[model samples]
Target: MDLSSVKEALAEKSFDKIADVCDNLMLQVASKGTAFHDDWPYAIHLLGYFYVDDCDSARFLWKTIPSSIKEKKPEVVAAWKIGQKLWTHDYAGVHGAIHGYDWSQEAKDLVAAFSDLYTKRMFQLLLSAYSTITIPELALFLGMTEDDATTYVVEKGWTVDATSQMVTVKKQAVKREQKVDSSKLQRLTEYVFHLEH
Candidate 1:
């Protein structure tokens, strides 16, 4: 189980690499006609998927895990709870699962990284979806207290009304000039000409 590559990726907090390496390792191990023994780092692998926002892969991995391994490892089960919350789009539940578990030293960093990325992703979603939302709702989505959420959004340049406690999302309008690929256009033209003839 040459996990040097996995260890290197974990050291750098490169979750994409971790997910890829762990997945490849799983395949390699499976090709050997054996199951993932106790040596396998299931918690790290699951958290790696969550960190990369690959919930589908995480879910599949969980399903394919050996029942014996699942029963033996509480850490793996805890990590899957986070994935389950993520699959259900339960924002608060995601945070709850994360904080609820006592992760091993090997997996602690990845779990914290996943929580941070999840919060930031949710904040981005909130930006696109709401013009004005209450601080309590923002806290729920961001997994923070109302005060922390208010401070966070304010730091992100959102305006909060003192009386209403409604934080006005700062929407940045992106203006992209659509460019047509000339080669694609020429190919389309050629195909149309042939069809017409």
Candidate 2:
């Protein structure tokens, strides 16, 4: 799959093939753009949005970016910061960026409301649920698997096959096995209940 493959797929209405091909093409197209600073991180930020649940990592990646790049390159820095905030689920961050752009007021409101914690929690769930699945299963959910989900999970020290119903790189497995006080799950449920309400 390459640039031409993407164009042809879109022409044929092959939406399922888009993510796989677009990942490669997005990187390639971004590489061509002239950024005073390298746009690799910014491009990666875009990928983070597609993953939805990887925002913690995405947010950290943005903040860790050295001032060396942020200070010198306004265009790259601007895009990076906006995308990073979007990944972090800071909706106001996006509003600040696109406020004066051609977007409609409704678009701005939608962007502003998007960072609600429920949305973040949903992505967090996805990252946990799909992290340990086989290439085939992941490809089904993500619409692409040109990358290895299992390797990513292992690298993060998450255990797999807990239920053995299917591989799930559950967040519970990654956390240390401390005795769970009922209070903890109680608080967790309350938090989610509050968020949902």
Q: Which candidate is the best by TM-score?
A: 1
lDDT tens digits by residue: candidate 1, 35-124: 667878888898888888899999888988888888999999999999999999999899999999888888888888888889999999
lDDT of each: 0.89, 0.47
How does each model score on TM-score? 0.85, 0.27
TM-score of the candidate numbered 1? 0.85
What TM-score does model 2 achieve against the real structure?
A: 0.27
**Candidate 2 runs further than 4 Å off:** 1-47, 50-53, 83-93, 99-197
lDDT of 2: 0.47
For model 2, give the RMSD to the true fold.
20.8
* Number of backbone-clashing residue pairs for each candidate, in the order shown: 0, 0
Model 1 spans with C-alpha error above 4 angstroms? 175-197
- Please state the error at residue 11 of candidate 1 in Å: 1.2
Task: Give the true-structure RMSD of model 1.
Answer: 6.8
